[model samples]
Target: MRAVAALARRSVRAGSGRFLVEGPQGVRELVRYAAPSVVDLYVTAAAAQRYAALVESASAAGVFVHSVSDEVLAAMADAETPQGMLAVAQQPEPTLADVLAASPRLLVFLQEVRDPGNLGTVIRAADASGADAVLVTDSSVDVFSPKVVRSTAGSLFHLPVVTGLDAEATLAEVASHGIRTLATEGEAALTLPHVDLAGRHCWVLGTEAQGLPDHLAAACAERVSIPIYGKAESLNLAMAATICLYASAAAQHGTQ
Candidate 1:
């Protein structure tokens, strides 16, 4: 449908409170984790046959499934290889309270990141590292963007990704909950391992270019750096999130 294709634009997806997800993996994950949120599923006839169990599972869950022409599916998809399947689903809604209720011990925040690929990768890293949730602050890429959804592969459905938040307020609130807020600043003297991660912690990462605003970084409990043993210039957003999150995870799990 032309309407589904139009969802490739961030404004359109936001205006409609809906988003389109491509690939069978994302669709299958949606069915498994959040079936009630699915609005409709569109599949090429061949995809319907290839991924018959997914079609059956979605249908059994009461999600509307349509097997259309390959051309129609192509129109609905944004990926170069569309997996011949696409799905429209309501955007996930998770409030700050919802995030806190999960008893989050470790958290990650992206402050004003612009790249959808980076955002999605950070989300996937968060899920793999067993983070409770991820927060994308103001000026960040829209999490529902098709590019972001595609980059997430399926982790977007695995964890709660809180978006469109005020970086200052959210960090303040997280700090109020007795969590140590550590902003990743390359120039900082404290190393990631120097921090006491055995307690609750929240790692705040900045943009690729500007990093965090100076005042925001100052507001955190401490600013730390991931020690670079090699001659690399710096770690990208995804690598930083992955390293910081897993550090906490290892500290928590290994000690147990």
Candidate 2:
């Protein structure tokens, strides 16, 4: 138990790069998708009694289940609800090359997006919208933070998320890949619906408070805005990113 707790806190776990996964839903997904890498599965004694099916499933999958005391479980949990089960599994490494390898054609670059919910929502949207991967530049929240992971609601397992990108290098790399970058601004000439987001594109979303950085904006192939006839000053970063990514998807898929 102590070792499991230590592993959860540390960044490294053998060569697998494991991280702790909490909650019933997350554990279930982990067992289904990453069963082999699951090291220790913990459940409170009461929880074990209540969630017999989950316990059985983990046990059948060769996951070691511990009926920990409530206090022990609480101490290990990052959330308040402490969903009966947690797993330690490998954290897949995603790189720019890997992302491009998946789909060299289109991608989304999230610049300085500080909110975990926003970051996770964008990742989920990227997955659903068929984006290659999400490049999180410096100034964003940690992609693997608990809140971000929870916000993803299991989409974290499906999508590739590359973080810690140097803005200039990222722009250069995307440009080299033939990705035409687009930035969202309040005062852009073209609106999102009018842009030709057909091929090899990178839709860049900016910070919530401030839009894209000047250098990054300059790096873009074009600047576009989401025409808002409503009274709101600006749309939320995640909503705007979703609209932009979907627009690109629509153009690429010929659904526009």
lDDT scores of the candidates, listed in order: 0.90, 0.79
Question: How do the residues 45-105 of candidate 1 rate in per-residue lDDT, one tens digit apiece?
Answer: 8898999999999999999998889888887888878888999999999987799877798
- TM-score for each model: 0.97, 0.86
Q: In terms of lDDT, which candidate is strongest?
A: 1
Model 2 accuracy (lDDT, Cα): 0.79
Q: Candidate 1: lDDT over CA atoms?
A: 0.90
The ten-residue window of minimal lDDT in model 1 covers 247-256
Alpha carbon lDDT of residue 79, candidate 2?
67
- Clashing residue pairs found in predicted model 2: none
